[model samples]
Target: MSWKKSLLDWWGSAGYKKCSEKNRSVLKAAVSLMVVLFVLAIGVRAEKSVVIIDDGKELAVRTYAGTVADALAVKDIVLLNNDEVTPSLDSALVSGMAIRIDRATDVSISVDGRMLPVRTQCRVVGDLLNEAGVAPGPEDEVSPALNSAVTPGMNVVVARVVTKTEEKEAVVNFETEQKYTVNLPQGTTRIAEEGRNGTAQQIWKVKYKDGIEIARQLVSSKMIAPPVNQLVMVGSGLVVSRGGENIRYAEAIDMVASAYTHTGNNTSCGVAPHYGVAAVDPAFIPLWTKLYVEGYGYATALDVGGSIKGNRIDLFFESYNEAMRWGIRNVEVYRID
Candidate 1:
C-alpha cells in the first residue's frame, strides 16, 4: 500500500492524462515531418539525369541545361588541356544546342610494329588512328574504319600484320679485256698471248618490310661471252738515210742556247701557247734549215735564244716584235736535218 499505491493514484489524476495526450500529438507531428523530408529528398534526386557518351561520338553534346560546365560535369566528360570547348564553360545550355569539344592529342602510330609520331585533332578512335603517322600494314586490322568518327575515352586496337616477301631474280654484268697480237702489214700475224672471259649472273633475294632489299645472294655466275682480243704488230724493216748532207746532219739543240723570254707564264692567254713555240734539237736537225712544222707554220732557225736548249731549237724572227707575237705550243718537227 505504500509506493505502488501512491504511483497508481498520481497517474489517474487529470493533469497526467492531458500531459500524455499532448505527448502523443507531438510524436505524430515528428513522424509526419520525417516523411515529408524523405519525400523531398527523393524528388530532388530524381531531377538529376544521367548522360551516356558512346564511343566514336562527337565531343560537342546537346543538353537542356542552364550552363555548359554543368552539363559536361553531369555527363562526366573530361576535357584535355589542349582540347577546345565551344560556347565556353559559363554559356547557357539549351535543348538542341551543341557543345563542341575539339581534342588535340599526341598519337603514336605503328607500321609493322615500328612506332611513328603524330599529332591529332580528331575526336574518334578511327580518325586518330588514320592521323597516326604509320602506314597501314598488310593484313592489319583497325578497330574502326578509316572513315568512322572519333569519340572520347575510346581505345583503338590494331591487329595482326601479315607480310609477304618474295625473291626476285636480277642480273649483274661484268666485263674484262683480253690482249692478242696481229700483224699491221698484210700477211703478218701474231699470237694471242693472254685472254679472259667476261662474266654475268642473275641474283634473287627476299624482300622484307618497307620494301627494304635484303638477303642478297648470287644465283648464277658464268662467262656469258668471251671478250674480243686486242691486236698489236711488231716492226720489222728500216730504210737507209736517202737525204743529202745538209738534211742528213743530226745534232743536239740545248735549252738557253740563245736568249728567248718565256712570254707566256702562269696566267692564261686563251688558246695560244704561253711559252715560245717548242723547237726540236737543231743539231739533230739544223738552223735556217727551212723545215715544215705540222701544227705551226714554216719558221726559220735564225735567232739563238736562251730558252732554246735541251732538244729544243730557237727560231728567230726578223724583228723581236714577231718573236713576242709567236705563242708557245706543240709542233711536229720533220727534220730538214
Candidate 2:
C-alpha cells in the first residue's frame, strides 16, 4: 500500500492518540522549567543600592555588579597607586553598602636640613607625618601646624629646637679703700693690705634651631672667689719737741738760716730788730708767729726781708761780730700754734 494509505490507517488506530497525550505532557514540563530559569536569572541580576564617599564627596549609585571592584569599575572610577579604598576591592557587594575612597596628594617635607618628597592620602599634617614615620620631639616646631589640613604641592618645615645650659668663668675686679690714721707720718701713704682680682662663674641658657644658635640668656652669676680689697693708710697728725719742751706743732721744715745785726731800721711789722726776732718770707711764716729753730733757740717772726723766700730765714743778733760768727746753715724750724 502507498504511504498516504498507511497514514490514514494510523489516524483510526489507538496508538496515535497515546503518542499525542505523551507529547503534550513533555511540552508542559519544558514550559515550567523555562519559567523557573527566567525567575532565577532576574534574581541574580537585581540592582543593588550603594553609597560611595569619594574624597569627602557623597555619591549614590545602583549597580548589578557582584563585587566592590566591579561596582567601582561600572561607575567609571579610576584609582591611583597611592589612593586608599575602604572595603577592599575583592569584598562582595551588598544592598545599601557604603564605599570610601581617599585620594592621594603630593607634598614636600623639610626636616633636619633635608628635603623629602612623598604622596599620602591623610587628611591633616599630623596624619601625614605619622604615615611617613616622622615623630617630632616635644620641643620641635612644625610649620603649617599639625592640625592644619594637608594640601597638594604643599611644603612643610620642621625646625629642630634644643635648649642647653652652659657655665663659664669670668674675672671680678677688686676695689680700693683708704684709711686715715695718726700712726703714719703726714704727707705719706702706705698699703696696709694688697689687692687681688677674683673669679666668677656665669650660667647661661642657650637655644639652637636646626644646628644654628638662636638665642642666649644669662641665667645666673655667682662669685667663685671673693676679691681682696686694697687698704691704704694716710697720715693726718704730727708731733715734735722744741727747747726742752714737748711742742704740738702742726708742720716742720728745714730752712737756710742767715744772721743780721741791728739794721738801725724798724722791721716790716714796725718792731725793733733785736735778739729773738727773725725775718722770714711772709708766705712761709706769718708775722707775729712763734717758732722754734734748732741751734738758734726760740724766736718770733716779726720781720720780712727781700731775700727771705721759701725755706730761707734771717736771725737777729746783738752785734755785727756775732752776726758774722753765725753764718749760713740748715736748721729745722717748727711752727708752734
Candidate 3:
C-alpha cells in the first residue's frame, strides 16, 4: 500500500505533471521492470513434490501441473500395466506431498497339484493366492502358510485331504487241532476233515491326500463267515516197544492166529517149542523174528507151519486150557524189519 501510494504521489507532483508524455512513459516502463524482477526472484522452481518407487528410491521432480499423473509425466516417469500407484493418478499434487508406485511380479502357484499362472503386486502368500483365485479348505494342507512372504520364482502347493469308510474282504487264518485215539496204529496221522480258508467282511476308515492313500483306521470288523475247525486223529496204539511209544512199522498183514503150548513137539525149526514162541508163514515173518500178539504177550517167531500159509500164525502158551480159551481171532501183525 505504501509503495503504490508513494508512486502515485510522485506522479501527481507539480513538476511531474508539467513533464512531457515521453518522459512519463519512460518512468512507467522502469516501475513495471522492477515489479517483474522481484516476483521472479522469490517463486522460481520452489513448488515441487516427492515420488518414491517400489524399491524406496526417491525422485525430486519440478512441475507446474496440478495432478499426480501430470507431475509424473513432466518428469518422464513411465508405468507398466501391472504397476500400482498410491493416491491415484488423478489426485491433486501439493508441495512436499509423497507419491508411491508398487511394481508387479509373476507368481507361480500349484493347487491340488495343478500349476496356475498369476500376476500380482501383493507381498504375502495370502494376497497372492486370493489374486490367483485359489482357496484352501480346513483339512487341506499348504506347503507355505498364507502369511508367508512371496518372492520371485516362489512355488506354492496345496494338498487336498479326504477321509472315507470302505468295506473290504480279508482272510482270517485257521487254527490246527490234534486228537489222539487208540483205534488207529501209533506214529500215524489221519486228517479227519480238510481245512478250508475263512472269509471276513472288514470295515476301514481310509484317509487320502491329493487322491493318494495316506493312512487307514479300523472302525468295526464283523465275521461274515465262521471258520470250521479241522479235526485230525492220531494213533496211540499199545505196541511192543523197547523204545518207548514208537509204534511205526514198515508193513502189516491181517490174518487169523491160534495158540499152542510148550512141549517136545516137532516144529519148522526142528527145536523144542517154548511158551513164548510162535509159528508163522515163512514168506510173511521169518523164523526167529520177534512178534507181539495183540491182547496177548510178546513172543519169538521161532517156527513155521505148513498150515500157517499167507498171513497165518500160531502162538504158544504155557497152559493148554489158555490156548483153547484164546481160540482163533483175526489180527493185523506188524513185521519189525
Score residue 157 of candidate 1 by CA lDDT. 53
Error of 2 at 26 (Å): 26
Worst 10 residues of 2 by lDDT: 242-251
> Which model, 1 or 2, shows the larger lDDT?
2
TM-score against native, each model:
0.24, 0.39, 0.47
Best by TM-score: 3
Candidate 3 stretches with Cα past 4 Å from truth are 1-50, 62-67, 70-82, 93-97, 121-124, 127-133, 171-192, 229-337
lDDT string, candidate 3, 209-282, tens digits? 99999999988888877777788877755444543655544345577999878666766777777777789887
Q: How does candidate 1 fare on TM-score?
A: 0.24
- Candidate 2 per-residue C-alpha lDDT over 193-290 given as tens digits, one digit per residue, 9 for 90 to 100: 99999999999999989888999999999999989999987664556665667755545778999999987899889987889999999898888878
**Which candidate has the top score in lDDT?**
2
Q: Which stretches of candidate 1 lie over 4 Å from their true place?
A: 1-105, 108-176, 180-182, 185-203, 212-215, 219-337
Give the whole-model CA lDDT for all candidates, comma-separated: 0.48, 0.85, 0.76
In model 2, the runs with Cα more than 4 Å from the true position are 1-66, 70-78, 93-100, 170-199, 223-337
What is the C-alpha local distance difference test score of candidate 2?
A: 0.85
